[model samples]
Target: MYSKKVVIRYTATNVDQPIICQLVKKHDLDFNILKAQILPRREGVIVVELSGSKENFDKGIRFLKEKGLTVEPVSKNVSQNNDKCVHCGACTAFCPTDALYLERQSMKVLFDAEKCNGCELCVLACPPRAMEVNIF
Candidate 1:
């Protein structure tokens, strides 16, 4: 099985559609909603961790595009600027994936890149602007 982290953005017109549901029922993909801002009758975004076979994953993404949803892959270029970071643990509080964590022994901020889904919440939560995301 393969897994992908992706961001889906849709306008108010598409808000009520069962686009994500179709991925599971029709394409046999499993999706976990990581973060969502599905405001009623407003443009919103959702971050999901989708897991399935390669073919099912591709087909599900294609279906989303066909339904006029803007599907973008989670950028793999999320990083923390260690030099600028103070290790205050602020970002860790908002990290849904536990990508940012404080070491138990040292209390230092540690970033695990592989676990990061690039939801970008840490970027907003960081006080010193230490967490950064670059599309790649």
Candidate 2:
């Protein structure tokens, strides 16, 4: 089995659609929704970790694309702008995945992109506008 994290974005038109459900029932994909903002009759977004055999994973991706859903890998992630950063820990507070952390002795910020869940909390929480999300 294999797994990959990805983000899915869809407009209000797709809010009532059960695309994710179809991916599981029809394509035999296992999905873990890490973060979601699904409002009624509005734009919806979900960050998920998809797991399955290689063939099932590919089929699941194709199904999402065919349904007009924007599917992107989570490689595009949060990054700190060194010039604007103050080494403060504000952004770290909102980071649910521990992607951003503070160095104990140095009192500096540290980031691990691989652990990122693409929650986008750090972008809004950054006081110095140092944290930015790189969307694909």
Candidate 3:
């Protein structure tokens, strides 16, 4: 099966739609939602790993775009600049994978690259802009 991690951005009007559900029912795809934040009348974002035949995967992505959703490959890399990090732990709360965590005794934040799914939430939550997403 073909599989890839992707990020989907939803506009206010499309935030409530069951678009991902249709990917499974209509396109015969399997998906694992890594992270999501959906709210009524507000923009939404979801990070998911979709699996299916190559043709079906292409079709599913096309379907998303047609529905006015923006779909892009999840960043290939997420990194933290230790020099810039104050270790405030803001990113730990938003990280779905626990890739960012605090060393309680030292109160220092640490990152485990292997645990990261590249959801980009940490990048958004980091107060010092220490978290960085690298598409390349």
TM-score of every model?
0.62, 0.63, 0.60
Model 2 bad stretches (over 4 Å): 84-136
lDDT values of the candidates? 0.87, 0.84, 0.87
- Give the CA lDDT, 0 to 100, for residue 115 in model 2: 80
RMSD of each: 6.6, 5.8, 8.2
Q: Is candidate 2 or candidate 3 better by TM-score?
A: 2
Candidate 3 error regions (>4 Å):
76-136
Per-residue lDDT over 106-136 for candidate 2, one digit per residue giving the tens place of the 0 to 100 score = 8889888878866678888988889876543
What TM-score, to 2 decimals, does candidate 1 have? 0.62
lDDT tens readout by residue for model 3, 7-99: 898999999899899878989999998778787889988888999999999999999999999998775457889899999889989998898
Distance from true location, Cα of 94 in model 3, Å: 23
Instruction: Identify the runs in model 1 with alpha carbons over 4 angstroms from their true place.
Output: 76-129, 133-136
lDDT of 1 by residue, 12-128 (tens): 999888889877899999999877888788887888899999999999999998988999877566888989999999998899889999999998999998888777899989999
| lDDT of prediction 3 | 0.87
Candidate number achieving the greatest TM-score relative to the actual structure? 2
Cα-based lDDT at residue 134, candidate 2: 57
